[model samples]
Target: MPNDKGRRRRFGSVRKLPSGRFQARYRGPDGLMRTADNTFATQTDADRWLVKQEAKILDGDWTNPDVKIAFGDFAEDWFKDRDYAATTRERNAVVLNRFILPTFSDLPLREITTPQVRRWRTDLIEAGVGAASVAKAYQVLRAILHTAVDDGLIERNPCRIKGAGSVTHTERPFLSVPEVYRLADAVPPHCRALILLAAFCALRFGELAALQRHDIDLEAHTVSVRRAYAETRAEGLIVKAPKSAAGVRTVAFPASLAEELAHHLAEYADAGRTGLVFVGARGGVMRRNNFRRIWLRALAATGLGDVHFHDLRHTGNTLAATGGASTRELMHRMGHSSVRAALIYQHLVNGRDHVIADYVDGQIRKVKRPPHGPSGT
Candidate 1:
């Protein structure tokens, strides 16, 4: 007998079945100690599993030995623990209810197989959902299954199965410098500064609309992006932290743009100390639909065709990258969390080879090749 307090206790025991396979037996979650039999290459392998189980129990994160819950019920439990924005929660709920739950809802998670998930994906494609949307639906399913695995409700995630078709990534459309200037000139006088900031500073539309007098420093020529405004189904407009830590940064503006911002502040920013820098005619947050209407009308006025408001931010990134800004500088200015995203903006600018060649030529002319040691003396 082993001391329960001082020594590691051995389970009910390993026994050889009639087929000559060794099986390890252990108590399960039902308060009834049960034995799980499996074939192991050696006794050492069985011992290793016992050690792992002990460690999991000591850490108080042990998963149940058996999984038996329906995936739909488990998903509800998983959703209860997640803290997400109202819109994000709604979007996830829609994906789960419409696409994911119907197939896997009543089935026990432990019984789900890769074949079933593949069939579900095939049905989604046949129903006219794009590959990208299907991929997103797959991601939602994967996340839910991952949570179930973590909680010991399942042994592995079936959604990890491969062979999903390539997901089409949407590229952001950007405007040329000339197009940017034309847009700036065509927008309503009151909205021109906002549009210019979006194109020149790479500010997101939400961040641009959330700007307050206190967030801009005219003397420093910088705008602090601390908050953003987003509309939710339940909440019309709500202010939230800039999406990530990188987003909560102070980005510098061109001196000329800073001057324009100063003038706009003086003319339109309300007498209230905390007034919004850009607002609706009724002194509320600017809505996306209204801004899109204004942008389309401005594009027509400028003789430009079919430009989305988001292109202004892309135009800003392209201008910075093409004007000899380093990747680090672009990342800082654009509030991008990864170098890859910064590179995408840099690649869109074009004509970098010519710029690099001119720089190399200038450097070569300045070098004096070791003072030309006289005729190889």
Candidate 2:
């Protein structure tokens, strides 16, 4: 038997198992026993593993469980522990089941090497998975491994290996001004005001869909972004608070726009505080798919080839940028988490720098430059 010090150490020792396979055993932070096998073909391999295990013991990082558990199993445990939204949880579970689990399910959590992760990432890219989706999957794996590390299941998170973040994707798409007007003309008259408010006020689709009669103040010309609609795999449609605390804000509307919304509320809204501002003809929450069909019909009528309804929010940002709104102002209006998002909208506006140049030119022209002194002089 090893000395008492070695036995008491968190990462205990390398010893031969009954089947003659050398193994390293340790006690994890969770107070559970764990073991890692040294399936070396040669004594050199066994020696190397012994050295590593001793070093890990000194560094206080070793915690390899003895029983071989699949990466998929560990990932599931990690997922269950997270306090994610119902919809988010379901979506993450689906992605894991569909994309991640099948590939690494049988592999031991501790045995998953950086090369394997890299190869998996490469395979995902080759299989036409978008970089964003792959990145999200990577995040999920990283999070799982991080929890494992915290639980003392492993010395470190293998998912945090270098070169695990090289994925890239195109930016989110938005719409143009004319496209916005065309989209407005496409939606039904009852929904037109809501659509305009969405595009012009930069309200998210969920926020617009969940808007109640009391949330808007026509006299004050403001709309409060208090709640949003969300759909979960388990619970279906549900109303929830804004995505972030900062998302709860009161947005000032233009006078004309306020009047338009006021007129809409009086004519279409039901006689109750909880009445939805924009609902289906039968007076229920607006379904994205159903609204999408109506939106497509409207786009066709306006002769626009193809555009997403979400693009209208981009149109709102573009319109704000064109109207000389500063990035900070735009961010506030759009409820963006970062100014970088607001900058994308700035690029869509025409004559942006030209307008500044024109202003500079007017100022420079005011100071006639001494009639351009004679060339000889």
Candidate 3:
């Protein structure tokens, strides 16, 4: 039991107040005495708090409460530190301005709590935000808060909702080999090779759109993916390297495609080593929106409605799996850095176990029958 006397301590002091409470005061880095806002019921509580404050000061983690930065300001700085692609930067900016800033822009970084984060996420969902959109916004928020934690702006990240950043997508449609060819024939004559290459080579639309005449070696039967294009509202068309290091690989094509690709290049593709291989009717970049009508018409004609253009690549991967391609081979052919997408093809091929089972049944039948005589043979 401390009396009405005060005891001097290193960097601070603890005193028993006349109201029968213990008060703690410390000299801040600004050379001013900062007293605890409320009194502690026990002298031990007051001493513990003062010791913690001193430890923070000694460790250079003490932040001036009055000069704390706003969440928006810190987040802006965090974004500027990274060199993001144009499309990615535009997407992050949209989420920040549309979802994050409205809720916690003015709040100081230190003031945000886990409950506040949970409430904000709930509010966004209640306001009719799509699950995917909410997930994206939450991801951006978590990234910002994660950097805040690293910078010592806060002790912990408030974005702690498990699985809050993941968006669940419905199964994508898959196309059959005959369906792929039907759709290819239904499209315009100039785009026949484009559809074939997309389905057979598993090349993404961006990779196909950015292909140059020099990238394809008909003699070598390979296509080199050196660059890719991204269409963004702000930049219109931004050309960059492949999304991953593995994406910049040379993929092989069937000998049958060599003639078709040659014909397309000679007749339709722009002339020059750097000439665009797949362009619009008027020799412009093939924008998806501009060509959507043509694609839709082809789908309607082929009776393959609601199939996305990307499903061509999926179909190609499925065929590759059926052809006995290994996981590493699929990864290389599809230009994927991770095995996650490659594993999907593995799962798809599991359906072919019925063929193995049928082969086993045939073997069993052969054993059950009597040995064939020379005359029967």
Candidate 4:
């Protein structure tokens, strides 16, 4: 029998098989023994393969052959490990099943290439997937691959399509103060306070929907955002804590609406402190699907049909910005966890260009003219 330990290479060991083929094996980064996919025809071929693997290891790009996990298998584990909100989890699952799996389901995590990622993205756009959808799906895939890299399942993430993960959103419509009240009036009597609170308090629809009678303190002129509602197939109308730590804040409403709020509490609000602040016609939890009917009717009646209900929050944030709210203040008031969203809303402050121009003119005038005595000096 040939000395089965045929040769000792610099990086790993090569052994001659019973069938006269040479096999290469090495210890991987994960401290596990790994073997090449196929036996080499000769000892030189096995040594050459080991040399290449050693070079890759030195360059920090070697992947363990034992990590033959398929993309679908890794993705299943990835999804299970995610601790995102219910709605976010649902959205990710939908995107994975719809867009990602069809392209890379059976492919090994290590076999995914950057060129393949680029082509997949191109194919998605050509197949008429919306730009936003493509961006979202690309983000999901990139995130999964990044985790795979961190987990040492792959040498590197192959998601290198530049700007493929960004989506440009169209400018959203914002309502004027009068337009907010007009829409509020157009909605049903019970829903008027809901609309006004959404606009003035700068509250998200879920936050408003999750409100309870005790969360509002008319005397304090503040509303406490302790929780939010999310719609999910797994759990209908799941009530959960705020989206972020900053989301759990007490926001004040102007005292101008105190009367409206008190009246709403006495008339429309349910009896208990924990009772729903806003509810359906039958005094049940408010759902967007059911509320869309009322919302569409109010839109038609207000002649502001094109406006999205979420735009009310935009209008509120814009008003706050124009009122000279700082970046930090905007983040707090908007319950934003990042400065990005706060800055986006802050840019909507009208007349800022004129304000800047006037400021520059004032500086020039101050330099040109100095205060003088009555002698006109």
Candidate 5:
């Protein structure tokens, strides 16, 4: 043989480095020579590492050690690979740009450690970022890293901070029946029905904005939630499906609202059956910025003190619970996709139990009362 000393081995080779540590190199199945990402202190340890790489290749699980995709590039591709709603995409974009990508953009996916994620969250909170914003940012970061793990780009997710993605929901004040009527009376004449329906029917603002005359059945006192409106920065206001399958429901309203509905239809509503039931003063789509001014004024006039429009839905759910709506019934009425949310309203039913007990006592007295004639048995 002609100088076999300088030739490389068939599977792998180990050599003592000038630093006295051993390095391993192997010929990959891709026909390219590759080196271990780490150095070993002895030749035996280096041989063991190369043997593991050979085992990975033979088992069809070998991933390129040198695949150094940057986090921002992978995250962009991950976001694009999915078909998300316009609103969801917009929110994710905001979270990524404002919180996540700035910290981890240049770091390679495999190099992101759990310590770095914890530090990032701590920095955001220390910088006075709101808890909700931090939670959303953490959730998005965890999701992106989760996908990276699934793609075999990283061994484990670095987002191991327990419950960091979830935020505690602080209970907000809801309108009472009188408060609801007062707020309704305070708003503009055209929006009175909107307030009532939002409070009683538990309609979302988007659902109310997307309503057409045909969506309401005055005779049946039902509102069909077929579609909803979402304002995205990328596409302005767009009509899309409801947020969930449970949202695409037809909910019955109290027959008492019939007069209010009829009055709104006759006065300020668009003419045709297909025409919008509620519109801005310009007779176009209802934009939040345009409507919020009037809403705040009405809140001030009624002394509601900055009650969000969604609080009306909360009030409605509470009312339904007090009216003896079961968990399933509450879920259906509120279009809640999960029992967990419906259960929160169900907890509000505790105070109604006193009324239930009094009613039962009256029924028992009616049954146990003496005979009508002469106190006969």
Candidate 6:
């Protein structure tokens, strides 16, 4: 049969419609002729479209053009089908509602383009969002789009901006040994061991908050971390397993702190074996906001400037590095799943290196004076 160009065509046909627009049609793998989604301005344009459709079908990348899936529906299903912890679920939902969905929710999966992704990230940064928050939002968006690509809803993911999802880590402060103890003493009598354990044991605030009388072994000088309390405004405190398997291991504290730990439990802890090790002023479950008030007062009393509760754990990790703890040991102590974070602490092992250098220098001096040194006896 003659094509709309008034010539014989090989495998597909292009015809000029009554409206004078060129329509492309080709036999799909199902042996049914499929029309292009959009009409072209010219017959050659329609022919080019038909060639692409044939290429896609032959390449096994054929997708039904009739099915139009919106991004919002797909992304919500993606979020629901996964097995996420309660805290992670809450965070993903927040990220979707606040950052991801507002931009691409109603759009078709195939319609999301690289330019749109780049512009969306730029708008977020221009809108005064923090770099870390924007990075998190970008990561969530990239993850959802990646699922779309894998599902064959989109040919490729649109989130391809280099370094768009990475945030530079700012250095956080860690207190010295004396500073940790001073801050501990500045807090209430009940909170002394809290400070000591935080700075020495390297337990996260969440892990520390979830600690119970049974989790501590004064005799072993070890604290078992099994669960952690993850709290969000939408969801109150959620007791969940540690984020990683490494987080579930036991951490040994300095033997010197065992007495203080025992004393804290005896004097202030709840009456039962499973009682919360750290409780609120009224002996109820402790929340971060409530404990933060105490932390601030202690900081003020010690004249320490703006210390976050998390910094105590960082301090402990630095101290571990100073003791020449290996990367694996730091990972275990920090409850980190990877050596990257542990390596940061190793880089901060200034004290141990100095001691080694001094010891080596002393040994060298003791080695029969280097070939007629002027000041040597």
TM-score against truth, every candidate: 0.73, 0.72, 0.82, 0.77, 0.80, 0.80
Task: Kindly give the stretch of ten consecutive residues in candidate 1 with the minimal lDDT sum.
Answer: 368-377
Model 2: per-residue lDDT, tens digit, 48-67? Answer: 76667667667877554565
lDDT (CA) for every model shown? 0.70, 0.68, 0.80, 0.80, 0.79, 0.77
**lDDT tens digits by residue: candidate 1, 278-297:** 98766667888788888888
lDDT of model 4, residue 44: 82
How well does candidate 4 match the true structure in TM-score terms? 0.77
Record all residue pairs in model 2 with backbone atoms less than 3 Å apart, i.e. clashing: 34-65, 34-66, 35-65, 35-66, 186-298
Candidate 6 lDDT trough over 10 residues, lowest sum: 368-377
178 in model 2: Cα distance from truth in Å?
A: 4.1
Total backbone clashes of candidate 2, pairs 3 or more residues apart or in separate chains: 5
Residues 300-338, model 3: lDDT tens digits: 898887899888888777767766666776776788877
259-375: candidate 6 lDDT, tens digit per residue:
677778888788788999988788877778888899988888889997899999898877777666666667767778764444434533544333322332333244333321122
User: On lDDT, who's better, 1 or 4?
Assistant: 4
Clashing pairs in 1: none
Report how far off residue 232 is in candidate 2 (Å). Answer: 2.6
Deviating ranges (above 4 Å) for candidate 1: 1-67, 163-166, 338-377
Stretches of model 5 off by over 4 angstroms after superposition: 1-27, 31-55, 338-377
Q: How well does model 1 score by local distance difference test?
A: 0.70
Q: On TM-score, who's better, 1 or 3?
A: 3
**Where does model 4 exceed 4 Å of error?**
1-62, 339-377
- For candidate 6, the lDDT comes to 0.77
| Strongest candidate by TM-score | 3
